[model samples]
Target: MYIFSGDFAFLEIWYVSSSIPNMLVNILSESKTITFSGCFLQFYFFFSLGTTECFFLSVMAYDRYLAICRPLHYPSIMTAKFCMILFCVCCVSGFLCYPVPIVLISQLPFCGPNIIDQIVCDPGTLLALACVPAPSTELICYTFNSMTIFGLFLSILGSYTLVLRAVLRVPSGTGRTKAFSTCTSHLMVVSLFYGSLMVMFVSPTSRNPAEMQKIVTLVYSAVPLLLNLFIYGLRNKDMKDALKKVLRL
Candidate 1:
């Protein structure tokens, strides 16, 4: 907690907290009969948290850029109070951005065949099950998803490019190596996450075969959780030392 305490940390905690428990229960339990209201709530939250994650990832990329590329200004730019406000904006954007797609999808009528292929309340599957073909709704949701994913992906790419250029400009070999080391894990995590999401959503057919989709979804969700623990804890010496101290305390 001490090592990763802040707005981004809190947002990360909430991101995982929103969906992990339900996912765990669904994996262990047999009955998956979620009520109508429950389904919509789950769908809303899953996407909302995902949006929050996207925003937070972009914020983190900016944080790293500032820390490495503009170290002298980073202290003033990323002050605690500024971080809090940024996080609030991220949360609000996350929650507010998805309502258009969710509302458009939810208003559709599901006549029958309520079986949603794959784990969790997938929005695409829900649309597939709707009684009438909702071309307008599909177009809106697809456009929104594409815009969010690609926009953030581009932002992250740009930030990392700046960071890389700065790292290359460091005078000493040791300085360059240290600077690169600080960002490699984060870059890897971001690549793994955005790559999976792009494959999952940015396509003509997002609702692929259930088994294949489930595998991809699990890779994006569970694998990232494990990787984050390893990257943030085991990869970083300061975090490892902090963990040891916390345990001892």
Candidate 2:
């Protein structure tokens, strides 16, 4: 889906491309020390990428809704110019949303232990390490995180609900199956990606066990990219043929 489609090309590719290499390096190296500035930059890009992903996925859901529910108008409505506008909006929004929160988190004093327990520079871990209690920054960051995650999630859900209704109205069984296959693959990837995020970030628990946090973070970071690679590579006929041609070269 990501490989062949304009909707997914930049955000998904950029995300997995940025994350996996760093993750691999961390795994390969015995030492996992990150300087304070390095940690802040990582946190900045990590959240920015994640926020961008949520926005892009919501854009995809909107695309799917148009394709499924308004087939006749999908082409007209989802024109290249319009898609470029959306792509720009997603990029701008993703980049703009996190810098202030990250700056706030960075300003907080880290007097004592500097070791971050997780692979990535998670905000929660940063909060834990703050020299003074920082309720205000916590509230700001959590509020932004919640709104971005749940707000986009709700939009995706609503779009898909309409899509399901439209799919059901199709007279041909084959048409319904085809629509469902596409939607099911998208939904599976969304659930895998967002479910882990919700558990890791949005859950009510104030204190998550460090080991559990690492495990969940690893899964959330790694699994969706692998799933997307296979789902699109093997299941998408166009993408498969394209890959074959590339391999032949």
Candidate 3:
């Protein structure tokens, strides 16, 4: 989730940066002469996809919780209808949340400063290009980032809060053990996602793009997803059992 979240955030920023002309574009009368690189457009498309994948993972987690904790109700709770509805919500929300920011960022004229101090296009870079005057585009970024962060935090908190309650109440010792395994996996995922988010954002300002690149690459590309695969895949007993069954051992 952290990987996808940051990737989507970066892509939306890049889409604007790549499409719009530099701050020079706004000052110059021939701004319309500017064009974006085709390669950047392709990358934008690639990065934007992370949003969809993140949402789908959330939906899948919800399904898993329903299956385990509410076995009898799982069929009804995770009905095909419910799954479709959740999928649509994820898809629509991703598109709606992303494109408007791209529009706002594109409006920021990148005339005077062409050097983007990051691995990829980011809100910081586009806002820097506000043509000597600080671009109000950063305002748009704050509103969007805050809104998305708060909303996701609330939903994630709510899901895990209920999950904790479910895990604690299992009757049998073995059942409790299994429940704890599931709870621990979910907690690990949540920690990896939110911890990386805070590390990247709630920090002293970077001196250069190199610092930002290192952060963005580690938190968004590698660590969190690796944690996900570890906690949810390798640690899953059913998966282990299935592997054993398949090997006839």
TM-scores vs. true structure, each candidate: 0.89, 0.89, 0.67
Give the Cα error of residue 146 in candidate 1, in Å.
0.8
Better of 2 and 3 by lDDT: 2
Estimate, for each residue in 1-249, the C-alpha lDDT of model 2 and write its tens digit.
342254564566676655567767878999766778877877877778878888888888888898888889977888777887887898899989988988898889999788777878888999999999999899887887888899999999999999989998999999999998877767877898899889888864257788988888878777777777776557767878988999999
lDDT of 2 at 185: 67
* RMSD per model, one decimal: 3.1, 3.1, 8.5
Model 2, position 139, has a per-residue lDDT of 84
lDDT, candidate 3, residue 52?
50
Task: Give Cα distance to truth, residue 101, candidate 1, Å.
Answer: 1.1
lDDT of 3 by residue, 118-141 (tens): 444555554655575443556666
Backbone atom clashes (below 3 Å) for every candidate: 0, 0, 6
Clash list (residue pairs), candidate 1: none
Put down candidate 1 lDDT per residue, 33-59, tens digits, no spaces. Answer: 777878788778777877887887898
**C-alpha RMSD between model 3 and the true structure:** 8.5
With a 3 Å backbone cut-off (N, CA, C), the pairs that clash in candidate 3 are 22-110, 22-111, 23-109, 23-110, 23-111, 24-111
Off by over 4 Å in 2: 1-9, 17-19, 238-249
Judging by lDDT against the true structure, name the best candidate.
2
Give per-residue lDDT, candidate 2, residue 163. 93
